[model samples]
Target: MFYEASDNDHKHGSFSEVRQDLVSGDWVVIATGRAKRPHDFLQEGKKAFRQPKRTCPFENLHENALLSLSLGAERGKNIKPWVKVVVNKFPAFQRGVCSIFHKTGPYQWTDGVGQHEVVITRDHERSLGQMADLEAELAVRAYQERYRAIKQDECVRYISIFHNHGRGSGATLSHPHSQIIGIPVIPSDIARSIRGSAVYYEEHKECVHCVMLKFEKNDKKRLIYENDHFLVFAPFASRLAFEIRIYPKNHVSHFEDASEAEIVSVANALRVSLGKIFKGLNNPDYNFFLHTSPIDKLNSFRHYHWHFEILPKTSIWAGFEIGTGIEISTITPENAAEFLRNIKV
Candidate 1:
């Protein structure tokens, strides 16, 4: 159904109509005047963009190290380093007073009480996708360790772990690194996802993610990559072209709850997914983030399952998307998955 801005509905002005998806109950905006054909999104000669190593910040991050690991080293010998976890020099949220949630008239706010840290690898040029299998495993281990540490603080309600590759995905530094952030409140997007998952769980008496995985595995059309423990596939209602999600076959609620074997498998799955995108799409910019159960309450969110979402910079949001919180993809997810699945990384 379409919802146009009537005289009373228009607070400022009316330029677009809102359309709701019948199945997911999600809303989207369609601008009347501004629209582009799908062919406009296809351009030629895309190259992988990277910054030079001379001015790279991650190269000199030893002093800020919160945790460092040398993957394979013998006792009583020099240890060659693999990964380092350090406090982000510029943090979005910091250590602060968590007690106050002040309200001013109709507005409510609080201190930006949180922790932000970066997981950096030793290599300057190799991203997780290009890194060796062992290096990728170590990087995943670093993410888990930092997550385990940060969630212990009583002030933290949610933790986010994500990686931004290439310039378009919002990576300022040329070197590859993942970031972990701990915040006092659950983000609106995550809250909405949790609510949806909860509703599905109550209605079906099964994990919604598991149900999706089963269908995707059986169909094999939308499937991009899969291992013993994890499955990577393009979502049926993908918000962007080449959108990928990696879910553990096991119904684990928390990222930190994954066992050692599970962690390695997840790392492998992540590596393969990124590798395929890097090779197949001519190294397009992309962002991958984790969605897990909130750290505040464990048993309450048992219905929720953790997963990774990779969103490549395939298209830019225009007026229609900005006006109404909706995105349009130029390509079908099935085709995108098939293309990526055929790529030999």
Candidate 2:
């Protein structure tokens, strides 16, 4: 209900206001300019395409696996690996020796000198949410192993680990896989997040995320799932309708630093959260990504806490979001969390 406008007159210029979110300190545009009724966002459901295993590129992905793990003898030892991490054949950022910044026409550029790997699961249909808890744990272990290997290079400044589920979530292939990209510079979104947390830490001398976690745990209004080491909750100022964030219970600055027990707990929490979403919402498309401390400045980023976030494609972006850089989420996070929490996974 909160909005900001250039002028007080609501009658003129399709008046809109930019509201600053208290938690992340990011702005959101309440576009009364083109406001939408709540129910208008409940669009028709999408049909997920299932490509045949014969045509799927990942089905033959047996070679160049950076790390591979097996399920059990039940699946038979001759079967394809249960989970594997391999170099992305078509990488956004190609691997090469680290490069120095070179100037060109008032712009700076560097060789995309970083590793891009894909974490593939053997199943063509079973996503993380649908997989067994043990299977999900193995996949998460692959992520950690690759992260540990990629972060060792001094040239690498940031590592992005993300999963694209379904076609709507930008998955060109139907197979279940996650991507890891190492880059030379910190992404702008992550930089902003780090700076915001750093400022809060300077003011309060405690982890900002920990403070939020404590409040959310006691409040219980936004919490959906929790384990010994992690909690899943809808963010207070969600950019998307059903945005979910998974945070470690203990304050950990780096994802790579998580212990084996902690990783398993996180995997459990992640699987449950995703399962609830899949069941309750009827398998919506979504993207989940990890946010962790940059590899270059470990000491300075200690105040920052690492977490994973999932954003479901519940709504589409229109002019207001594109023009103002602020997204309008129709559903309040509390309601979304309640809906998700009540669903049995």
Candidate 3:
């Protein structure tokens, strides 16, 4: 049986309803009531775009250092003393006792045991989009080096590397930087995705993301950038305007498995796509995070695709959105892809 709203009960205003995928239990917003006008998305909700260069902490590199890569390596020119991979002085997590699971009064908590480090570039004003491909590649290399070093710790369950740009996306400072958070618990979102992929593998003997990559690579409907090792596209079920994801074409479980050459290629893909979004959307604040197969599962999740999720801060959560935990995307992924496709990086 099917149902439709009749004219008597129908009202006129663009709104959105989120629909859940039956098989995967993932939510996708059905934009039946797309209320946003063109200019509505351009405004930054919480992003404090500009900062005083004089007070910028990164400009004077006397802070602590997790690891540093020189400018001559990637920037192509040694303009004074330049380095990447500066340790955040105010780190979220520091060297504590190993993450010992503890039982509180009727509650359980584990030590926030792990590492929190920032991957910062030399130039204070230049964002990743303004950097050379080699520079971007070096940033990725540092991520790899750090991940390898941190994962050996017994208390660490997962290491999440992510970047938040502008205040709207939760960057307290205006500096261009990325962060790595190593935690003892597997993130809830990643767990859900892993379960979904596992169920899909059991039922169909194939990974759902691989299926999507194959389809997107063939159709080119949502694709924004493609290289030998990676592909970036607006997801079929995008969470926000101009939301893009970068995926490895190969079925690699761990991002750390990526070779130096593959890392460079992935860097090019990331930089170019980010450049498109940065240019096309007029420097929208965004966040990018890496989701890879868990280290606990050995030789498993080989079917899963490792990827990066880039979510631009284009919209805010309303009551409906907050209550339901579903994002309403006004602009269709197709249209968003079209907008980015025209932008030359």
Among the numbered candidates, top TM-score falls to: 2
Q: Higher TM-score: candidate 1 or 2?
A: 2
Q: Model 2: clashing residue pairs?
A: 4-17
Using lDDT as the measure, name the better of candidate 2 and candidate 3: 2
| Residues 1-345, model 1: lDDT tens digits | 544565322231345444343224576444433543333344347655667787888876656688887677635857454899988889999977675788999998988989999999888878888876778998899999999999888889999999998888899886889999999999988888888888888998998888888888988878999898999998866777788999999999899999998999999999999998877766778999999988855378888889999998887889877886688665656667888898887
Best-to-worst order by lDDT is 2, 1, 3
Q: Please give the RMSD of candidate 3 to the true structure.
A: 4.8
Q: Please write out the lDDT profile of model 3 over residues 1-345, one tens digit for every residue.
A: 466755332333446655454325868785757545434566444344778889988877786677887645325654733446765688777767786778989998976777788888777767778788877877888889998888887777778999998887898878788898777788888888888888888899977888888888887777888899888888876777788889888777788898777898888988998888777677888899999876674676675667888998887889978998777888767667776877898
Per-residue CA lDDT of model 2 for 258-332, tens digit only, reads 999988998998899889878877788899999999996537899889999999988788998888778987666
The TM-scores of all predictions, comma-separated, are 0.86, 0.89, 0.88
Q: Which sequence of candidate numbers ranks them by TM-score, best first?
A: 2, 3, 1
Backbone clash numbers for all candidates listed = 0, 1, 3
lDDT of each: 0.81, 0.84, 0.77
Which of 1 and 2 is ahead in lDDT?
A: 2
Poorly placed runs, candidate 3 (over 4 Å) = 1-24, 32-40, 43-48, 71-83
Give the TM-score (vs. native) of candidate 2. 0.89
